[model samples]
Target: MSGLVLIEPTELYNILNQNTIYPCLSDTNFLLLLDARNKLEYDESHVITAKRARCDGEENFAIPYDAELECKTHVIIYDGNCRSLREKCRALQCANRMATDGSKNPVKILRGGYEDFSAMYPFLRTQKIIYLPQELDAISTYPCEILPSILYIGSKEQATSKAIHKDLKVQAHLNLTKSDDVFFDSAESEKYLQIAIDDDREADFGSHISKIINFIAKNREKLRTILVWSDQGISRSAAACIAYLMSYYKWPLKDAWRHVKSCKHTVRPNRGLVMQLSQYEESRLGSKVTNVDDPYY
Candidate 1:
């Protein structure tokens, strides 16, 4: 694995997003996404700009000898599992050959392959459920588990769905929406709290932060899971989660945000919320904390 580079789904997503804003960037530093899955699976659903490359049998996979592809600054390939050393070797050999032929394109494999990538972005799957919410439809397209069984961040629909609650066995919920839709029932083992707040930059979550953090602390010993959600699961709820992490774990704003985004890549807290969280951090630490300016992609 000396020359092999592994790219995470979040990194790939960032690259694609950056390319969209700067079209010329792609022309100069192109990324060629190769799907190493069989033709059938590739045809059904693949990454947005992925092209199929056969990795087994008669014609082993090879990078196309095209000026555009050869000139790409980075190339990424993903199989169903990407666990085969032999396949990796073959792919690397092809890349070496291309380099020898003066292409010099660096080749890498997607970490965890297509499965992990699709898990991170379920909407990319051709046969995936589209969880649409009333507000923030664009942002609420996908819900993600941010902390395995312990915590989840998702859309309002996911928060309100009884089936989803049962499936995930979420024993507790912290709702950040103004709606009265109840998803969790009161049980000895379960708890629910809803903070009626709008998703505005100036929305004040000052009063609710301590309560939410206390709820999580109380449930920690019982092994109860909590789901935090807002209209789109992007801004208000995400900000709350960041604040909880900072308070409970003594984490700085940027570190807590990075931890959350590692699991829920789409979590984006608004600037006002970021300011509030930074203030919370400063108050907690009795010192000024660095503010994070960029939103999570």
Candidate 2:
């Protein structure tokens, strides 16, 4: 269990859409996404940029040519509906081989496998076998999955995308933008909520934290997914999403911020929002533990 790592589909998605961190090789070679399913199943459809994991005649995993297992920053393996590593499933077999191959990081098994990943993010499914560096760089952007199918955070551009709404099964839209224009149309009236604010330090989210958290809670009760977005999907929406996590999960500001940031790498609530969240945590926990002015924030 210590050697095996289970990565959610959303975490893999975020990794794919961004560049590798301090890679010894190109992004394509640095990140190895392996499909552990059979050939026919893989040929029909697989996650974009994923390679088929093949075993040799001696019953050992065959390392793909030019793919440096020792140098690759990430090696993620997946199969159909592989929910656990305890199973003798192909995903587990493939992952076990790589985890011991001295890779740079722990070999990641896509939790719930292709069935769950394709269901959650259908747009990422592709029949393409290979990708050029430029093509990988140009991959379409979407909302960050903050809590699996429950909550997402993104930019105003993603908020307005119908394709994103349909593929991700987005049921609610929370706007943290200063735009006067509406994101959802008339038919989606019940699915929309807006919190108009600039990204300045003066903007206050404290007044609307309750409303935002409640809206997310109500939608989650209905088993619906909500997408929270702002101008860049980096600041205001990040703050509100973190705020919601604090109230719903009763986690301290530090934990809440870390969780959200792990899901979306670009999340950085402005200094003002950090102060507000620290205060919110203090009010709930009876003491402030997080330093708002800390550069680590």
Point to the candidate with the largest lDDT: 2
Model 1: per-residue Cα lDDT at residue 159: 80
* Consecutive 10-residue window with the lowest summed lDDT within model 2: 17-26
What is the model-wide C-alpha lDDT for candidate 2?
0.81
- Residues 161-198, candidate 1: write the lDDT tens digits: 77666656778888888776575543433477778888
Q: Which candidate leads in TM-score?
A: 2
What's the distance in Å from true for residue 148, model 1? 3.5
Clashing pairs in 1: none
Cα error of candidate 1 at position 288, Å = 1.6
Q: Which stretches of candidate 1 lie over 4 Å from their true place?
A: 1-4, 7-52, 55-60, 63-76, 80-108, 112-140, 161-171, 185-189, 217-225, 261-266, 292-297
Give the Cα lDDT of each candidate: 0.65, 0.81
